[model samples]
Target: MKRNFLLLLIFVLVVIAISEGIGFQSIPIGKFNIGLLPLVFAIIITMVLGIRIFRKGIIKKIYSKENVNFASKYLIFIMLPLMARYGADVAPKLKEILSIGWVFLIQEVGNLGTVVLGLPIALLIGLRREAIGATLGIGREGELAYISEKYTLESPEGRGVLSLYIIGTLFGAIFFSIFAPVLLDLGFRVEALAMASGVGSGSMMTAASSTLVARMPELGETIRAYASASQLLTSFLGTFTMVFLAAPLQKFMYGLFIRGEK
Candidate 1:
């Protein structure tokens, strides 16, 4: 455990060093600037290292499978409380969401847009059970839990969702950082974008909100408040949608459009 903690600390410091080192280089899209290449590069490097370790059997020699599994499980124990704190931070500012009126409320409903958008695309692409799970699931812990409970992680569905969750965790922030600024340049209101950023993932919300706040410093607090409220709504309601609506809806869509039901 001490070794694992030391490794984790070293890993974080390396990532931070890389992020700062590469902070100056950025990709510019029109008037908007998309930085954070260092962060992205760090993530890719970590992924490549992990893949090499696992595929080359280096991981087994260096670390016991049980210890690795223990780290993976307990890491979530650390993350979940931080996430809940993010949700808790929204409590005082939640009424601000109401001030934005029904448009914010309506956008909250569109939090399920993943299932709506992804299922069709997955079907069109002729994805099967496991791929369907990745497509329909929002790629969060709640969705992961539901899928794991119903279908073990070794199942195709579980693998699908887990893969999506991994991808989402690694790149979702960078994508949102770029995408949010582009949307703003396209003339979307900050309120709408703030609410949109709250799609239940704290990493995503942080990325989007931070980018927007950097761009428009005057609206930083408002943007954060709206984002927090929207995120809270997503986290709260996303649970119900994943368990009751998303899974069933995906199955129904597959049965209706595709040939097999598994």
Candidate 2:
């Protein structure tokens, strides 16, 4: 129990720091680029605390049924908006909110939203259920590819899910492209604004903006920074969002697709 509380605190602190526009360079870990020193410190704190808690058998306690239920409710309230914001960003209204400095809070929540919202969306769009098996990067790419191939369903169902992913990605791309100008107009350093918003969108917006930056080298660092931060935020936020929404989404599934059958 203590471990979970401490870990959550550390994560919240990191979120606060990222929101406040603080970051630093660090050693890379394979495919992942490490963030600022404070991030490193926070990670270390989490690791140390987690190890300590493990020795005390607190994890089991934290995962007890009652605690899990409480955590689930909290996750629903916090994570739903996060993902909703992420999926709906292809417009000006969201950008306007960022310009006023709501980016930090929204971005913080967004890191948790993708999974909360992404998985349910994936299920509804009919991605063969196997694609989501790879959602957490828990298994190998070959496994997901194999599952998708073996469970190939009707062409129409495949197309439908693909269409949903397409729409989601399009919204992410358009939101960043349109918002870039707004940030520039607001006198925010292009890279900073990009970094902030990209994190919120799970780096899906990075390619769109990076292409734009490629045409203008002056924006390279900003684009790189945005991509880096966004990717990290996405991994962490997306996973937590999934954990948070799992229960609620399960209930939703019966209502939307399995009504009266079960």
**Which candidate comes out best when scored by TM-score?**
1
Count of backbone clashes, every candidate in sequence: 0, 5
Query: Residue 139 error for model 1, in Å?
Result: 1.0
State the displacement of the C-alpha of residue 207, model 2, in Å, after optimal TM-score superposition.
3.2
How does each model score on TM-score? 0.81, 0.33
Model 2 spans with C-alpha error above 4 angstroms: 1-108, 111-160, 167-175, 182-192, 196-203, 211-219, 246-262
Residue 162 lDDT in candidate 1: 93
Q: What lDDT does model 1 reach?
A: 0.73
Tell me the alpha-carbon RMSD of every candidate: 3.6, 14.7
Give lDDT: candidate 2, residue 9: 53
**For candidate 2, lDDT tens digit of each residue in 1-262?**
5667665455566655753454333334554332333323333343454454563455445445555566635754665564454444323333443464444434555443433555566657765443333232222222223234644434433343344444443354444444454455556666555655454333245533553354346755545545444544545554454445532453455346545642
